[model samples]
Target: MKELTPVTIRPPFARYAHGVEIPAHWRIVQTSGQLGIRADDSIPEDAYAQAVICFEALSEILKSAGMTANDVAHISAYVTARDHMAGYMRARDTFMAHATRVPSSTLLIVSGFTRPEFKVEVEVLAAAP
Candidate 1:
């Protein structure tokens, strides 16, 4: 009797992959740390607002890199106000909702930022297929 093959067997398909492997090669792109400066070089006065601004800027950079928030592998957030931690997280969640996968992140509270008017700054690393 001849062996029969399984009719349900199918090859896997990659979709929205975070990375792709090639023969003896890998292309990687690392972006410069982005900040919350508007086209006119204006920054928001509030920390939460500044965080939003930073996220917006980072989003654009990520898009340009052939990725989105879902591709973000890690992130670092700096804040000057410790009491406003809740507000900062709220903003983060809002921004992350647009992503396919929520990336790991770190948050730090500092006494001051480079600009007195700026409240928060965020840096991110992303990879995509």
Candidate 2:
């Protein structure tokens, strides 16, 4: 497998890369929507805490796939309320601080989740060589 490359268009879009080019033979690992629930099935109260937990869960999934946050090519984040957007962004930035390349991302403010307690849910797509 070859290394992944981040694509940047002429006109700047956002902080994240416009797209990622994955080389042939690379394996793609797509994770399910990860919530803030802990191992004991307990969820945090605040949006920030929930966002952190969600990212941690995503990290665990990537690790299981022999990948790291740096291998992530795209990310989709969902929040229950609009007011929680800032906190969610902070948590996401913190979680991705050490990444070599930031992934293309999408953020949405949704009405609710499967569980009422869940304030944040994150899904990630990773490319592994």
Candidate 3:
């Protein structure tokens, strides 16, 4: 994979690339948006905690496909409000800490989720050869 940061454009606002180029013949996997809910039917009130759960769930999904964060091509994350941005970013950074390459990322502030207690939701697109 190649990070596509053109000289003419401004650098990414965070620890991610403006774009990524996946090689031909690589297999791609996309995940549905994961909420912060746990299997035990527990949900955290904090955005960071919720985001962490979402990432962990995503990791499991990746593993099932024989891939990892290193193979991720893009990330799409959503939060309920503006205040959750910091927590979401922190969780996202920690999740990608071991990634071999930076991937494209998008963060959006939405009105809300299915459950009012839900503070964060995340999904990813990954590619592997």
Candidate with best lDDT = 3
> Residue 28 deviation, candidate 1, in Å?
4.5
Q: In model 2, which runs have C-alpha deviations exceeding 4 angstroms?
A: 1-14
Note the clash tally of each candidate.
1, 0, 0
lDDT for position 1 in model 3:
89
lDDT of 3 by residue, 1-129 (tens): 898888899989999999999999999999999999999999999999999999999999999999999999999999999999999999999999999889999999999988899999999999999
lDDT of 2 at 86: 85
lDDT at position 39, candidate 1: 82
10 residues in a row with least lDDT, candidate 3? 3-12
| Collision pairs in model 1 | 18-129
Candidate with better lDDT, 2 vs 3: 3
Arranged by lDDT with the best first, the candidates are: 3, 2, 1
Considering TM-score, which of the candidate structures 1 and 3 is the better prediction for this target? 3
Q: State the lDDT of candidate 1 residue by residue for 1-129, as single tens digits.
A: 111223465422311222222223323345565555788998866667767777788888877877777666666777778865665677777777777555555678877767677667788766654
TM-score of each: 0.70, 0.87, 0.98
lDDT of candidate 2?
A: 0.84
- Given candidate 1, what's the lDDT at residue 92? 74
Q: Please give the lDDT score for candidate 1.
A: 0.63
State the displacement of the C-alpha of residue 43, model 2, in Å, after optimal TM-score superposition.
1.0
